[model samples]
Target: MSELKKIPADIAELSFEAALKELEQIVERLDSGQVDLDQSIEIYTRGSLLKQHCEDKLRSAQEKIDKIVNQNGTLGTEPANVE
Candidate 1:
């Protein structure tokens, strides 16, 4: 059986931009194929976690935007008839 490695808590706490940047770096390293098998697996796991973090951040931001739009009845700065 393979042991599951834990993702660092700090990664979850990172801003979406920061997490995406790290994920991009990981992709570059993986594409280069310079890492050993074990290192590749480890980084791949980290990249997955980072991807999830970025997605969650995006979702949260979208929810906030939706709330504001619903309250103001506008998609942008201008008011609109939602109905």
Candidate 2:
């Protein structure tokens, strides 16, 4: 049997390398101005998605921080003291 692994494809799941590569290509295409009007719209749509993916990845990383706690009465971010 062959081994297979499942990987995330959400914008947040993209590696820094992959996202940067795609962003570079998008910039090149936008600069060339060779795409027909119809194609330009399509490329623009793709660029929007790539941008959003990168942003979502950053947001997810930030959310994972902010030590949330539920102690003594309420739930919210509170500094954790480890001893």
On lDDT, the leading prediction is 1
Across residues 1-83, which tens digit of lDDT does each residue of candidate 1 receive?
66434557999779889999999999999999899999999999899889878877787776666556643555553333332
Backbone clash pairs for candidate 1 read none
lDDT scores of the candidates, listed in order: 0.79, 0.65
Model 2 per-residue lDDT tens digits across residues 1-83:
64322323664466756875787798898889888889888777667667767666565555655445666677666553332
lDDT of 2 at 71: 63
TM-score, prediction 1: 0.75
TM-score of every candidate relative to the true structure: 0.75, 0.57
List ranges where model 1 is wrong by over 4 Å. 1-7, 70-83
- Evaluate model 2: give its TM-score: 0.57
Error of 1 at 37 (Å): 0.4
